[model samples]
Target: MAAGGRASGRPAKKKGPNKGTGGQKRRSLEGKGATPPAHMRHWFKDKSRSERIAREDRGGTTGAGGRAPARRRSEDAPEYIGGRNPVLEALSAGVPATALYVAQRIDNDDRVRDAIKVATERGVALLEVTRDKLDRLTEGAVHQGVALQIPAYEYAHPDELIDLAHDAGEPPLIVALDGVTDPRNLGAIARSATAFGAHGLLIPSRRSAGVTGGAWKTSAGTLANLRVARAANLTAALREYREAGLFVVGLDGEGTTEIADVQLFTEPLVIVVGSEGRGLSRLVREHCDVVARIPMQAAAESLNAGVAAGVTLYEVARHRRR
Candidate 1:
């Protein structure tokens, strides 16, 4: 037996199975009881939600051809209006909200109470969530214990626009956007078209702006009355409109004829507005029955789609009334 060695007393303390540090690995493997719900978890924050919203505000990061890439929310994402007053006013104005989120144990003030009442009358879903969840839903807006979700806008068809005019015993006057990708411009054009007695608006399915919250806000609520239709192939749609007795008039800065002098003013007309930077595409320009320009006094370079469409629509309305 050596000095520090285990003496040969009892078989050198027979080595048994390795127990893995008091079996603490099993405790680490176990989930600390049933997991808590996401809403209840403290660490579950709405990651990058604010960044996503900022991107959407910045026109959603344009992809190839200047079209917004995915732009998820405006198409399918539910928009939320936080704050008691905003929620109540939106509900009162018939904003077509899908759901109303109420903070649990919230102070039932008049605005919140009325919002809930109107939501109930309109059959909107009422969900009572914690304040933290409401904050997350509103992206940390001053929700004041409430939020209203507005669904993505629904667009009509091009043919439906024609039918809308026909059903009203009037000729179709549609505004077709050639390449305009700004929602604010779309909203302004929509406002002008509706005001000028146009039936609806036509936009390409791609490389065009869609009806969004920005559009809705810019239109000053005119979008509610005006219908917007989307076409897969803009040139092909223009051809179809031409075949159906509608005159396709392209608005461009380089046109020889002025919009007021176009002879197709009396016909069922589709005013095609191109993008601001590049006016109209070659194919769209060739497909138009008339390429017209807005008369300008000075040597201005160009007008945006909204301004050009406004001027052109006014001229059409004036000529038609004459």
Candidate 2:
């Protein structure tokens, strides 16, 4: 026994890296692995380069099928309303919501509190998640501590626009867009249509903006009160309206008839508004029974689809009132 130590003990073995290399071997897990589980991947996430090109080839629109592709979120995905005011307004407007997300430990300000109150009152699922989760949900937009998930808007049949007027014992007054892609413009048009006694709205299933949350908010909740229909082919829809005995009026900057001089305003009509830039597509222009123009002080001036729609609706309403 040497100095009270174990007689059989040799020099103490030195520790070598504690038997593991601080997760170095596990670093492979951090890199890209196999394709993630479908449920874990967000909608439109992890798209391959070819898939992106294919989407572009499709022009980011639904095709001749008259419906968006099955995989597209616009066809079947929860609509997200981000920003405090938009969320709170949507809640107040009784927009049916599937869930309400509040950032964990978010400042309980008036908008946030009101959002929570309305969501709870309406029995929307309230979820408190981390900021990262909210960011992902909003696609990196400013959520301002709250977000709402709503179901996609259910569009009525194009015929339903006429049916509604028939049911009310009045002429059909509908607003149809040619290729307007701005959701805010859709909302504004919705608001104007509702205010001016238009029966419903008609948008093409492709090459047009749908009734998204932004449109809903821009409509100031008027969308809830209006029937919105989608057309497989806008030109075809216009033809159908004509066959159904409703006048198809197209708004263009270079039209032969001015809005004030238009004679079909009081008739059962569908107003077709083209995009601000192109005015009207050639096929869509051919489909119009009368292409009408809004007189402007400056010949070079133009109106966005929303303002043009509002102006046209105003003229229509004026004629109806007379």
Of the candidates shown, which would achieve the greatest lDDT relative to the real structure? 2
TM-score list, all predictions: 0.67, 0.76
Off by over 4 Å in 1: 1-74, 80-93, 99-148
- Which 10-residue window of candidate 1 scores lowest in summed lDDT? 21-30
lDDT of 2 by residue, 96-152 (tens): 789999998887888888889888899999999999889877767788878889898
Give the clashing pairs for model 1: none
lDDT of 1: 0.83
Predicted candidate 1 versus true structure: per-residue lDDT over 86-157, tens digit per residue: 677667767778899999999998888898899999999999999989876766667899888878778797
Runs in model 2 lying further than 4 Å from the true structure: 1-74, 299-301
Give the C-alpha lDDT of model 2: 0.86
Error of 1 at 121 (Å): 6.4
- Kindly provide the TM-score of model 1 when superposed on the true structure, using C-alpha atoms: 0.67
